[model samples]
Target: MTPAEVRARATGPTAGLAEGYAQANLIAVPADWAYDVLLFTQRNPQPCPVLDVTDAGSPRTVLAPGADLRTDLPRYRVWRDGELVEEPTDVKGHWRDDLVAFLIGCSFTFEAGLRRAGVPLRHVDQGRNVSMYVTDRQCRPAGRMRGPVVVSMRWVPTALVGTAREVTARMPAVHGAPVHVGDPSALGIADVGRPDFGDPVTPEPGDVPVFWACGVTPQAALMASGPPFAITHAPGHMFVTDVPDSAYRI
Candidate 1:
């Protein structure tokens, strides 16, 4: 069933299956820590871009109007003392009246553009998660949040490089533009085969490795800081919102 259709039928496990709508990486922080994390996202717009921030205890975002944050995503990770303790299909048990949620655009938003542009995404084509790595590069620190910028990598044909560039460049709100376009080593990525998260994709002779700032940046930052209490969407499961791709232009 479609994610939206399934979501309508039941509020259970198949939470965000109807993807291709605008997807966002979610971060739920204790109210006291919300401002600091907001500052971090503001400082590093490329790696930790902000799409929306919800008032404490509210899951509905202006980005999607009536969408429910706690149940919209298929799964969530609950962290305590900076360590992941539970991977819940829904955050109902973790939800709190004092928590605030932030929604950041996911790379899938741009993948739609790439698919439209004919730039094949091997990871999605193969139904495998995109490869992501933590770079030696650091995001500008804000408050207590600081970590190496994490990136999601994809391989595209040499001939369609310009197409990949042009389409993604138009969607900065969803992490537009490739951060690195050639050698993986330039990004301090030792071996494309050894990714920190997600599976690796094969690079054909003429395909160049292209990396983008990932929506998962917050998860990496969360692990590094280890906040007292926080929640985030599971890696593959994301909130499919009512917004459209064109809404992210800027």
Candidate 2:
């Protein structure tokens, strides 16, 4: 589907949509907090890989010129004092002159490569969102931004784990490589069927769970830091960029 079509279906999550285009996680905060957020991303590149940052108060981004950040994404989450206040399909009403938007790399960009390499994504196959869990591990803090690491889990066949890693490792811009493979408990995940965000997909008997750092880490940090106001793409919902998937492949 085209990015516009994905936006038209704004109520649904963007996972598995716009196959060849790059998808990003959105984080918009007051300009005062931009530097800290940038530093946080720089420090935690795996989960918070920086893709683009808009000029303060402006929605235009080089990644997708002419796209409207306020209305282009599938869905948005509004936060007030770290509490979720709204989940809206459009954020035009919440757009502020002091808001700065940051686009972070999303693993969705690499799924195509995985599919090409014969690594099946059960979530996509089942029409469910990938499972995400908040781990006990804390990210490297930057200024006031600090929170537990969030991970997206996919069940990979034990034999294809290496293929999955090699395919994703080439796309460093979209969070290259797996952070953890096998044993979800090692990452403090108690139940494979339950997730803190997104839908859970059951693993086949021969599949082993693989974890990757997720863009939701920054949103978790923003919430923990108690930022007065913030906006982010709802988990699984993403901002589709005009850039091609190959542009980020290394």
Query: 1-250 in candidate 2: lDDT tens per residue?
Result: 7876776665677777889889999999999889989999999999999999999999888988868999988789999999999999899999999999999999999998899899998999998988999998999999889999999999999999999999999988898999999888999999989999999898888999999999999989988998899999999999988899999998
Kindly provide the TM-score of model 2 when superposed on the true structure, using C-alpha atoms.
0.98
Tell me, by TM-score, which candidate is best.
2
Candidate 1, residue 191: Cα displacement in angstroms equals 1.9
Q: What's the lDDT for candidate 2? A: 0.91
The alpha-carbon lDDT assigned to residue 170 of candidate 1 equals 87
**Residue by residue across 1-250, what tens digits does model 1's lDDT show?**
4445543444332212443556788999999889888998999888777888998999789877766788767678899978989988788878999999999988877776788788887887666777889888888888988778989899999999889989988888888899999888888999999889778778778898989998788888888887799999877567776777778865
Cα RMSD, each candidate: 2.7, 0.9
For candidate 1, list the clashing residue pairs, or say none.
Answer: 3-18, 82-226
Task: Give the poorly placed runs of model 1, Cα more than 4 Å off.
Answer: 1-3, 6-20
**Residue 209 accuracy (lDDT) in model 1:** 90
